[model samples]
Target: MLAGQRQSAILEMIAGSGSVRVATLVEEFGVSDMTVRRDLETLARRGLIAKVHGGATLVDGGSTEEPGFVTKSGRQAAEKEAIARHAATMVAPGSAIALSAGTTTWTLARHLVGVPGLTVVTNSIPVSDVFHQFGRPDQTVVVVGGVRTPSNALVGPVAVAALQTLNVDMLVLGVHGMSPRVGFTTPNLLEAETDLALVRAARRLVVVADHTKWGLIGISTIARLEDAGTLIVDSGLSREAREELSEHIDNLVVVEPSASGN
Candidate 1:
């Protein structure tokens, strides 16, 4: 196969399966290891796929499936780290915060370790595990009980009921997509419902998303643009998209990867 044909096939494979190993690609395309690596390099440069230790995974934006933790962790490592660091600075010590589930929120959970007197309410198993490992005695971690989704997020009626009973200082949310019309959305209906409950329970709704999520659309709309108290994104976003988002949301905080200490 020609290089262009091989690359197109590789993208099709990732689109269908979410990831592809280097060896697998080589065997499938009947190409040398170097050729497969070069193809992956080109795709990664275009932000179509993320290069992993031994393979490549499709980037998170516009994914059809709710990606597994391993897949997500492999993609957008630098962006997530930058977002986490900036998000951590926004948390006041001793605040009761509600965090939604996603790779970005998981990164934020890592930075929350040293934050003293924090009460974190979440439905993500990974977020709960982060606190279980390093949370201080003064800090409290509450995991909402519910059915687990493919993304390892707890959702359904139980999670929504739990969130409705509590009030939080801030809600840290991640979106599958963001647009002026849709605001924030998720592919899963149950997850969207749980997110809505969290939005209602918090005094301030803060959305943390990377640039890739800007133009995509999900199946369920969680909140309108006017509902967010603040929207935080990376500097990779286009100026036009940023201006459009800022016009609808009250406070828009765009943090650069360097300034965020990623």
Candidate 2:
């Protein structure tokens, strides 16, 4: 294939699969690995895709406009880790916590592995797996039963019913987007409803999202910003954006990347 043709094909593959590894692209296009890397680098420079350690993902895939696990996971890695670390500090030992399903929430789950005597209730397969992978005997995980969404979140009547029965001390929510007018929103309608249930089931709501999520609006609104007890975001957030968000949210906890160590 010609250089242009190869690049076009690679773009199509990323659009279809949300992400593409360099090795896979090289094999498919019968090109050298360097050629594939160059294509990805060009795309990343154009803001068409995000280049990660082993792959490239469509830029739109990270937004709620596209719901792909691999695509979302590869974007905002450092920001998510910072948010998760800050979120983990809010969870006390032996506390009953409700965790929503999202890339940021998954990061929090990984950090929660060492917390003892904690009861985690979640509707995310990966969230449950994180606990199961490294949870202590005193730490119990409750998987809320439901139909899984495209973003790997459990939703529907089953999930809502399960959440209704349990009362959690805090809910760590992950949203697709957040805007002053639209508040917290998600692309999936059912998942939005399920998230509302999660909000109702917990005494306090702590939303964990990176600065990228600000100003973006999704299809469905889960809750108003003021409803949340805390909003955890990265240091990259601008002063103007922070001021705007503070007006809507009650207790905004901006977690800077450097503060993660503390």
Candidate 3:
């Protein structure tokens, strides 16, 4: 195929899947790895995609455009599920937990349905609904009222004020992106502020993110990596990235999605 055609095909693939690895493209297109990079670079130059560490993701519209829940929930299905389940194990009964809005944390909310005598606070509409529908009679669900973001998170002064009044056992935060330099981040500034409030109200920060979240920087920083008491990720993380993140995080739990228990 012509160079233009190959690059166009690559763009379509990224548009369809949200991301594509160079190695996978190389194998799929029967081209060299360098050739795949060139194709990715071409699309990136056109602002059609964003080049990441080992792949390319759809350009996120400069931190102003937050993806909806449907888009994010589709990105890493198995990984998010596994990460959510693993994070749920850390919760003890009768604990007060704050859940931030995001697909991964929403997944974690589902797993918490069985935990008895829990107090759940969240800015996520879907997350609060999870507890409302399935929570045990002893559980208390605190819905933080505020303006909702594209990611379906209720953020702003209202949400921040609600969080300020109570301290929780743990805050399970799901972020838009994560990096060594900036820590956990979000594209929305108000959402970031609300997340900070959640962090402040918790004894420990438990972050749940997929491997793809690495290297994607957002507009606002939520917390430094070391601030998180526990970071849960899926097995898809590369060894180099894992070792790097481990340096900053106290307990880095990498869950294997393929495992029977996961």
Candidate 4:
């Protein structure tokens, strides 16, 4: 396997079990110990994992540590862009789409610019701005009012209340992390609550997440894997991870980064 593919698989292994021993990885990949160590080193430098005496572990408190939108926007650019492009294709012309706040969904908003006569409801300031700048006059953008979370998502009684009254054809959700066990999760408790509200407002739920989000667990879960009808991920997602997720989520769509132009 390629180096990037191996690292992605290693990360998923750690995510599934919390920690992985070097000996186990060596046996699994049939690679030299030095190769595994180098892989661990690379993942550590990226702040994706922590090295231990014998192996590595997923970074501690990833579930609770919330970074700002700008910080996250830089973390998984290619993967997010690819996932967003595929998600945008799912939107029909004149459809009402609900976008929950996160960097990936914000990327999805950028791809929605050309769709005609669409109505977008969102709590993200940046997402609303995308529609404001590029959306056509016939398109409608509704920004929900509420308190902003660290990730720049608006959430509170107000956002939830607004969603309770509106129904959309689809909801595109971005999350901090996800797994078969936790379904879809976010570090912020209130954001999880508001996201669940957004999930209820749509008939079809499509989750957009990158491979890096695989093993990380957030404090609160928005829904079980079964709740979402489809999940959009990038080509970098590992085969093992994809197979595991396929058992829970119905539709798993993988897209290439280069496929996105607009």
TM agreement with the true structure for every prediction: 0.77, 0.76, 0.90, 0.81
The window of 10 residues in a row where model 3 has the poorest summed lDDT is 253-262
Weakest 10 consecutive residues of candidate 1 by summed lDDT = 58-67
**Can you tell me which runs of candidate 1 are displaced by over 4 Å?**
1-64, 258-261
Evaluated against the true structure, the overall lDDT of model 2 is 0.84
Between candidates 1 and 3, name the one with more favorable TM-score. Answer: 3
TM-score of 2: 0.76
Candidate 1 Cα lDDT to native? 0.84
Candidates 2 and 3, the one with greater lDDT: 3
Q: State residue 255's C-alpha deviation in candidate 3, in Å.
A: 2.7
lDDT of 3 by residue, 1-262 (tens): 9999988888888887677777778888899989988888888888889887777888867655688888788877778889998898999999999999999999999999999999999999989889889888999999899998988899999999988998999999999889999999999999999999999999999999887788888899999999999999876676788899989988999987753434
| After superposition, candidate 4 runs with Cα above 4 Å error | 1-34, 37-60, 259-262
Question: What lDDT score goes with residue 236 in model 4?
Answer: 57
Q: Please state the error at residue 160 of candidate 2 in Å.
A: 0.8
- The segments of candidate 2 whose C-alpha lies over 4 angstroms from its true place after superposition are 1-64, 258-262
lDDT of 4 at 204: 94
For candidate 2, write residues 17-125 as lDDT tens digits.
5556677787787888898999898887888877654567556443346466766887677778888988999999999999999999999999999998999999998
> Which residue pairs of candidate 1 clash?
none
Q: What is the Cα-based lDDT of residue 114 in candidate 4? A: 85
Error of 4 at 227 (Å): 1.0
10 residues in a row with least lDDT, candidate 2: 57-66
Highest-scoring model, TM-score? 3
